[model samples]
Target: MGREKRIEYEGAIYHVISKTVSSENAFMEEKDYRHFIKLTCDAFSKYQAMLLSFALMKNHYHLLIKTEKANLSQIMHEINSKYAHYFNSAHIRKGHLFQDRYRSYLITNDEYFINAFVYINLNPLEAQLVEQLEDYKWCSCRYFEDKDNAPRCLNFKEIHNLSGIEIARITQFIMSKVSESKKYGREIKEHNSEENIKKIREISAEIQNKYGSIVKNRELKYLLVYALCSKKFKLVDISFALKMSYATIRRIKNKVEKRMTSDAMVTEWLSEIGKVNAFDYQNDHKVPGTL
Candidate 1:
């Protein structure tokens, strides 16, 4: 199947995710992260997009943005391409730096928008990269606590106006315990149900049975990981089910996601698996490419 067309419109809000190839570090050091932030500031200024929230992870980064015009594709292309060029040149590497084109999910409602904002802020915490959200210097979450020091890339005033909530309230939501905050999102709530678990298991088994003979063990594992994640199962849930560490599961998922974009065979296998039992592959409430 061909790539899905992005939904673009004036004043559209999006939850965007971009990952590096093979789960490599996108930011190798503090300077690298700072440089990426500089690029982001430039991109926002050039494109007239409002950067509401962001989190830079080891291998991936998330952005919650609102575009003034129907040009999200152009904005992201410039940011990713320019950053990729810089990263490759600085690191003295060749070939694609990013896994694929960034994935974006349209934010349609205030509640969902708030959820995405909190979700982006909580990424570092969820990955166990920081003991506290404040410790993660790469994320915009810290700026919320100290707006006076926030960089030009973020627009706190516009965020407040668009979200219709005070910054304090949004910060409170983000600072809530993971268990409580996880309950607010529709995707998380649905994935917690017994029915979703059953479907995920069914899908995993079908993929194994269909492709176990031809694919290598590693490849098959990634296929199962992709199936579970695409169905909205949390990384923790998948870790337990697959008997792998959380980090490993996440890496496998990223690998599969990258392959799906470039490899026709991988795409065909996943597309066939999605057909089994007539499973509902379309997750309307999910912010694609999120944790």
Candidate 2:
């Protein structure tokens, strides 16, 4: 079966998660985690994603984000690939550092967002990495506490919306949680099961880079081919000219034309990138036409 289609909606919030490959720890040191955060910052600047909250753990990481017109898959790939490259080179290791696919749960309701925020803030505590959440150095917990290196991750507006808690109360709540978790103990289990079942609707809107929103894929492919082709043709005209599925459209854009290409071209190209293997735009080395 084809890879499951990820649910993407405009202004959608997501709790993104990923673990180290083979259960091997992804972070060898604190510096590694810091580098991962740095890379995550880079990805946010490059993509159309907005960070409501984010936290990096020892074995796994979490990102509570809101996306506008970007694909989550591409965004995660970019962030993970860069971090992996950084970690591998730094540690002198040579294989996959993270699991194959990152887990993503789209958050469309306030309840889920709240739980996600709490869970993310309390990750270190849950992992037993630190006695208190704030004690963890690499997490949104510190971001919420100190204003330094913040405003990049924490969007206080969302926090302010919770029970009319202004920035002051927002900080108060977080600070209070830290102290409460310390006093009452971080061992207190925060239940997200009920909130996770919040009603969320799935959406399917196409937003290609620089290109406008496209609903159909067949024409998408035709346009991709046309762009690569020396042949001059209008997208509007082509859209009406041939009606094709969006997959065909995406395939066309990716230069995937099984019958159109010669056997030699097919063999050589397929050998490099077949059905199961394709160039990952997330990786600079895997990009086509780049030396």
Candidate 3:
């Protein structure tokens, strides 16, 4: 079969969804969900992708983002690939961890953006998991209230700007949506309930038990993300592409870099990870991980 045509969405708004492979639970606990947020907060910056809003549910995640030159494919790959690696080690499972390709819907209309935003935000309420949207501790519903940011990552300013609403108004809008909410998408509820959260704790504990032994390097993880997003490279060439210290990469992955013998299969994998050609001078001047 021919490859499906990718939707052209450069500098356009999109609603992206990624789910767990085998239709099982992806986020097993509150911290798992927090990791999802932290991952995106880091991933988005490195990719130059912009997040408008995002809502994390039990089995899947919703991301509303804008890409200038980079495509949705690369962003999701960075997320799914790294998260899968972490999840596999944590769960002691192997093979593909996420469903084939994440779903991306172009936000061509204003109503749909609002609908998507509301739909994602109301995930907990729709599932009857909570009486108030703010009650869902994993979401960013409370961020606008300036009370505290939910565990998940969200770039809330764009949606607020587009709606011409201030933070105060945004908080009011969220509360109003919750007040008028019904059974729409109520299926997002956490099922198999208590066992699920406990199971997550067990899995996380196992991973933590092995984390010191697993010895992941932060720089290597960064390199993998960078290499996964890069199109051309021999091992030496990729090695040269780094301005960051290899020791740092090794420290990041907590492992030595492996030798690549040109398996010929990496090209397609890299191709799936789209690239961005744009340059930002301001960013170039900034130090790594420094705001």
Q: What TM-scores do the predictions have?
A: 0.62, 0.58, 0.57
- Candidate with more favorable, higher lDDT: 2 or 3: 2
Instruction: Compose the digit string of candidate 2's lDDT tens values, residues 1-291.
Output: 876556665676677778888778888887887777777767777877777666676677888787766477778899888888888899889988889877676553454466566667776766788886567777777665565667464666665564255544453465455444343223223322212222110011111322333344443333344332322232222232234443453455445454335445433332222111111222112211100
Check candidate 1 and list the clashing pairs.
none
TM value for model 3: 0.57
Per-residue lDDT of candidate 3, residues 98-162 (tens digit): 89877666554455466556666676766777886666766666466654554333555666766
Error of 3 at 190 (Å): 24
Clashes of each: 0, 5, 15
Candidate 1 local lDDT, 1-291, one digit each (tens): 986446577898888888888999889889888888889889889989999999999898999899999899888888888898998899998788787777676665566677778888888888889887778888988877887877787998888897787886776667764554465444743333223334455666655565562135666667667877886776665664455787897888888877767777887656555665526554222111211
Off by over 4 Å in 1: 180-291
Better of 1 and 3 by lDDT: 1
- Candidate whose TM-score is highest: 1
| Candidate 3 lDDT (Cα, 0 to 1) | 0.55
Model 2 segments beyond 4 Å from truth?
158-164, 171-291
Error of 3 at 67 (Å): 1.7
Best by lDDT: 1
lDDT of 2 at 124: 77
